[model samples]
Target: MKKRRRDLIQLSILVVLGAAVILSLVLPQLPGRGRELQPLELSVIFREADTALWSNTRLGMEQAAGDLGAELRFLTLTRTGDGAEQTELLRREADGGAGALVVVPADPENLKLQLSETVGSCPVVSIESPLEGAGLVVAPDNEALGRELAEAVLEDWRGGMVLLLDTAVGSTGVAARLDGAEAVLTAAGVPVFRQTAAPGRLAAGLRVLSSVQKAEAIMAFDPYATEQTIRAVEAGGLGQLVYGVGVSTYVVGALERGSAAAVAAWSDYAAGYLAAEGAIRLARGEAYTAEELPFTVVRGEDIYEADNQKLLFPVTS
Candidate 1:
């Protein structure tokens, strides 16, 4: 009996020692128990600062930084959205120890050479606009977005005058949208009449709207065109369905009130999320490839749905 007790005590002592050794090996790596993650720094550079449009993007980058256990530094140029300014900003960011970069080239074509020289070996992602020689990109296909809008409108209207209100100085993506819209409408045997005006030129848009004598459905490229045409139609007693490429409180209200049909644009929040994720991956010595984001269309009927609400009003999209 004494021998049995001695053996049992020895076994108990061994078990305790084994547990102590295991804890010593595992406890040092537990983050919650005091160890902290290595915080990586990432940068998101935009062409310009538009809070209404880019608020969601900021939220998205914040979330991505959290998810990736990294930090985000957002940078933007003035309202001009100039390529030269963006190039200068890129140089500064690269010199600032930015582990990775995500940029929206104001003028991709013009800044191609500058980008090549500045980006160097660091991982760079492009959003909003494609940069020449940029391997990784994430943006909505403007042509596809335009085609989606045109297809949606074609279901109701046919073989009539379709008015397209666009900006006089449009970006490349905007031109792609216009091209897609015209191609689709033309193929469907509908005639498209386009009128151009500059941004912040409400009177110019309204003047163009007044000149559109007859239009079955009216589409606009920029927010100014969209909002101005909708306002003109309502005030002047012009009965025409309006659609466009942006969404705001006014646009959503218009959609609900039957003054607007639908609007198409890339979810800016999603853009930020994807861009941050890509930056994190690249910073971690991972690879990336360029791809186009999907287009989103919000109409009056399902605008209130949970998923749509998340996409449309996520940080005021």
Candidate 2:
């Protein structure tokens, strides 16, 4: 009888130990399995000091951030066309623990090192102009844009003098477009002249116009430059010039006024939307690739068309 009692006690102890082991394993998955993820905060910095270009990009980013339930901090460098100042602002944002960064570097090449440093701990996406070492770049294919502009000019004007107006020499977008224009113009046996505008000088347009000996077409690379060129051309009695092309709202307005032959524009809203989406994906440990937004050509006659208008500003369209 005592032996039987001893066996029962041994069985009871084994059952208790087994129950304890099972409880330890099951308790961990009960109501607390993994650590909760912290809410993400994203920062977007615009290179342009003025908020003129910020409108569409801001609208897209705000909408995307809202839909994704993420916090967004909008920061501006407050100076137009200053690369150094923009880089400083990016460093500050990154040091402050922003989970992701979206930047439009004023100078892509000069700002690459600084941008890479800032983006080391977080994802960095670029709009309009791309920098090296960026997580994702969102812009139009500038070479394609340039080629299209050149083709348009060549088709309309037959082998007459043509001048190309570029804002800066070192910009990737400007260089790409310039190369494309050069290739097309050369292939068509069209004589081409190239000129550079001073940084932030509207009077450069007047200077360029004065220097042109005889040109049937003037291709302005930027929208504001195109507008200034139109004013200068009109002032100099060169309104008879066949074609003017550029990129900008002012240029679009010039097209509306019959001053421009064609304008190439990528959806600023789509750029912003892509940047925001890229940031969110990075924050969530997801993968994304560099994206090139499509471009649209706005002609003088189609400037007011609904489809063209949609390309000008993407958010509302």
TM-score of each: 0.73, 0.77
lDDT of 1 by residue, 78-159 (tens): 7535667777887788777787888877677766776677767666787765667655777788788888888878977856
On TM-score, the leading prediction is 2
- Summing lDDT over every window of 10 consecutive residues in candidate 2, give the lowest-scoring window: 239-248
TM-score of candidate 2 to 2 decimals: 0.77
Lowest summed lDDT window (length 10), candidate 1: 198-207
Q: Provide the global lDDT of candidate 2 against the true structure.
A: 0.71
For every model shown, the clashing-pair count is 1, 1
Best-fitting candidate, scored by lDDT: 1
